[model samples]
Target: MRKRIGLLLGCLIIISIFTSISVSAMTAEEIIKKRDSNEYIKTAKAESEMTIVSGNRRITKTMVSYIEGDNGLTIFTNPRDRGTKFLKRDDDLWMFFPEAEDLVKISGHMLNQGMMGSDFSYQDMMESDKLTELYKFELIGEEKIEGRNCYVLEGIAIEGKKVSYYRRKSWVDKERFVGLKEELYAQSGRLLKAMKVNKVEEIEGRWYPMESVMEDKLRKGSRTEFVIKSIEFNPKIPAGTFTLENLK
Candidate 1:
């Protein structure tokens, strides 16, 4: 009987090891795809507030955004930035300033510039979440972030890809597949910025980050916080909303 019990225990141990290996074999690309698919709906609208903190000063701006597939449009509603609009379609990004009555294309070096003096750049705004197409991903390991289990992934931009961050490290929640933290790096392997998700809320059966903070590593004592005031999933958006003519 003792021999039979020992044999059973040995079999259980082997099964456990195989299970562990099977779980670890799941690729980093799968994690990114899961997170991206659940992040944004087919069509959505959001009212958000961006607060920029530099040392002791705080500047806040309110905006509304509409998104469909890879296209997005943002309109500032704050008194200071009222009438300023940003539009992104496919690979092109455009900004319109009512004060100047000019529509400027954001490209090349301008893509790296801060968006509206915030830590997030124009390229960041236009970033595509389809990691498989843009980057080669490697599963680093597992970690715990803010009391939640996470899978750490390192993504390197594929050759000939024009992505903003040449390298990125993301800590994705294991259960929800939400990114809890992320670090962005330049082509020189220099850390450029870091982002942390502070709060999350469920909207229409999907989890969404309600508040997140971004810090520009190049700037001392500077950080930006984005808060989603309200969001609607799969809302009906009028046609031509992403057109330059509609920007006027």
Candidate 2:
């Protein structure tokens, strides 16, 4: 009887190990796909507020944006930046300056720069691609973030793909499938940026990030907090809304 009990315990341990490996192998892709499905908006209109924090200084700005697939158009409504607009179509980005009456094509290194002096880069703001499309992910481990159980994964940029960050580490809530935190890294393995989601709410039966903070790791004491004031999902958007001519 004693020998039989020992053998049964050993068998249970082996089964547990295999179960863990199976989850690790399958969970990374499944988690990312579920997250993308929940968060990726096909068509939406949003009003948002951004507060740029540099040391003790704070600057606030507001904007309204229309988004469809990979295209978006944002127009600043704040007095200081009134009439400034940004339009993104395909992989191209364009900015219109109301003060200068000029339109600038954003390309090359400019894409890496901050958007409107905020912690978010132009590429960060304009990017609409899914994570699975950009990187190959592996489930590294699990941790708890803000009292919530999270699945931690590390992703390396796929070769032949253009990406802002060469490597990324993400903490996604296991139950909700929402991304709670992410760390972006440079090609040289240096930390470039980090984001933490502060609040989330159920919108249209999907969990949505309503407030978040993004920090530029290279810049000490500088961070930006973004809040979604309002959003309408799958609203009717007019044709040519993302056109360059509309920007002018």
Candidate with maximal TM-score = 1
User: Residue 12 in model 2: shift from native, Å?
Assistant: 10
- TM-score versus the correct structure, for each prediction: 0.92, 0.90
Q: Extract clashing residue pairs from model 2.
A: none
lDDT of 2 by residue, 1-248 (tens): 99999999999999999977876766688988887777888999999999999999999999999999999999999999999999988889999998899999999899889999999999897665588888999989999999998999999999999888999999888878889999999999999999999998889898888999999999999999999999999999999899988998
Tell me the tens digit of each residue's lDDT in model 1 across 88-108. 998999999999999999999
RMSD (Cα, Å) for all candidates, in order, is 2.1, 2.8
- Candidate 2 TM-score versus the reference: 0.90
**Model 1, which residues run further than 4 Å from truth?**
1-15
Lowest summed lDDT window (length 10), candidate 2: 19-28
lDDT agreement of model 2 with the native: 0.92
Candidate 1 TM-score, true structure as reference? 0.92
